[model samples]
Target: MKFLSFSILLMILHFTTYSQTIDTAGYIRGEMHSSDDSLVGYFKFDHTFGQNGQSVWYKKDLQTTKTKRFQTYKYDYFTSDSLYMELFEVMPYGFGEIRVMVPRVINGPIQLFYFPHSTPFAIIQPKNEPYLIKTANWKKRVSYRKFKRDMREVLGESSLVYKQIEQETLKYDDIPMIVRLANMNADESTIQDYIAHKKSAATSTN
Candidate 1:
């Protein structure tokens, strides 16, 4: 009886642990539609994990009155979890492009997932190094620096617009607790800073 109870307990523990692990092969898919209820586009995704790290592949198709646009991306590949989460870049080919992957907390099993969104044309890169910039522990300083650097890289030399976006981002960075409670807001600011910086840089180069 004692041995049988122990075996049952072990099985339960094993199942619980396995349940907590994310299946990288899993994906979430959906479509964009017009207000008139017409399908405007479709998206497919495949995320996987391996010895190297995590990788995300995305494909998008958009239909318009004039033409159809299609694009594919393989992004957020990294060797470390922190780097994978913070530093991976989104690179796309063709017309339909999505540059940002918003991290989402998966309920029940407790896993992280990415939801894609469209953004301006730019190179996607990690916000900052995890050790140097701890978004969790030192959110204000880390977020500020991350936003500043992203703006510089993306916008380049547009001092005016860079300063504008920097000020706005700094406001959000000041409230670490608020950021933690509302992760979506923080994610939005991160992407905004990236795009703002990219636009500023493009203008300067031109």
Candidate 2:
């Protein structure tokens, strides 16, 4: 009788611990998108725990999967606004490149990402550029001279945004507006072309 009672207590403890550790109630629906914006699959979204948790996905067929690093999760609830969370490679001051899941603030020729997890709270990736540019690192700091030079280099002379950077009219705080302007730049339409290329590649793969 004691052994049976102990076994029941163990089961109760197991369930109690699980309920506290995992937050299955906070599930949301979303679709998994590949790095190139291709749809990988659809699943219900959740974190292993409550608040700022790592992403988890569950399929309708009962299959489960963890978030794919460097991919994106498009939330279904934000249909009109279409919000996206993407995993990006971030290089913070005094550290090597690390991958963190962050939100894409502005999706354009020059994409702006918000990195709330660490220093250099913001980064930008220009169309076709392979590296992320840190907007400002509060620790190491960004000089105006270097900022202008780097923005010019990143935007390229042909881009209309480059003029603003060259003329010193835009500041670090104007990154979102600059990104919007970059999207408007006719020369930067290569981003659209790139998207088309990705779609073609995805179609071919399928």
Candidate 3:
């Protein structure tokens, strides 16, 4: 009877250890994406004890040299009882990059979020309520206005390009040089224009 009890205890301990090992609060969880949205490498995060945690991930072709590196981040929850996770990328030079924390939230579950190819913005209020906030960063808001205008133009152009590409593909039934070029150009232009617009808007708003 004693031997049987001891065996059960061992089994329980093993299960407990396994459970602890599998529990991770916030993590990258999968693979890193390349510039063109291709899966290049894998990353993993293991959190043990306390609110503070660390993560290690592999990024491929990080620099112009096409070299890969194992990037690490220092992470913490926004609040002690909060589910939101905050991560700061540790860089060798200057201040680290701050990004919003994404959590897996549940065990044995896959959570996927889309990152749109655009910039984000925050609102700023003037100290004086009646003050007319015409400029941001003491610069004319013309750049910001131009950016929004450019984005709309690019989106319209890309839509037309895509439609032409689809029609040509149907007619040719094969990859043609012109069609490929148009499609690629449209995609690149769209992303570039969107980013430019976002930057301008953010600057103006600030």
Cα-based lDDT at residue 25, candidate 3 = 36
lDDT of 1 by residue, 1-206 (tens): 33235335544543442232223343223432223432222333223323233334323433323433222223321222221222223333354322332232221111222322222233765343211122322311223345566434433444444454556643322222222223343355554554455456558899
Alpha-carbon lDDT, every model: 0.33, 0.43, 0.30
Per residue, candidate 2 scores C-alpha lDDT tens digits across 86-168 of 55444333344434344444555465554323333346632222223333332122233466766666676866666656665
All candidates in order of TM-score, best leading: 2, 1, 3
TM-score of each: 0.22, 0.43, 0.18
Worst 10 residues of 3 by lDDT: 127-136
* Cα deviation of 57, candidate 2, in Å: 6.5
Off by over 4 Å in 2: 1-25, 33-81, 91-96, 120-146, 186-206
Q: What is the C-alpha lDDT profile of model 3 across 61-174, one tens digit per residue?
A: 343334333322332322122232223221112233323233312111111111111111214422211101111122111122243332223224445443543333212211
Compared with the true structure, the alpha-carbon lDDT of candidate 2 equals 0.43
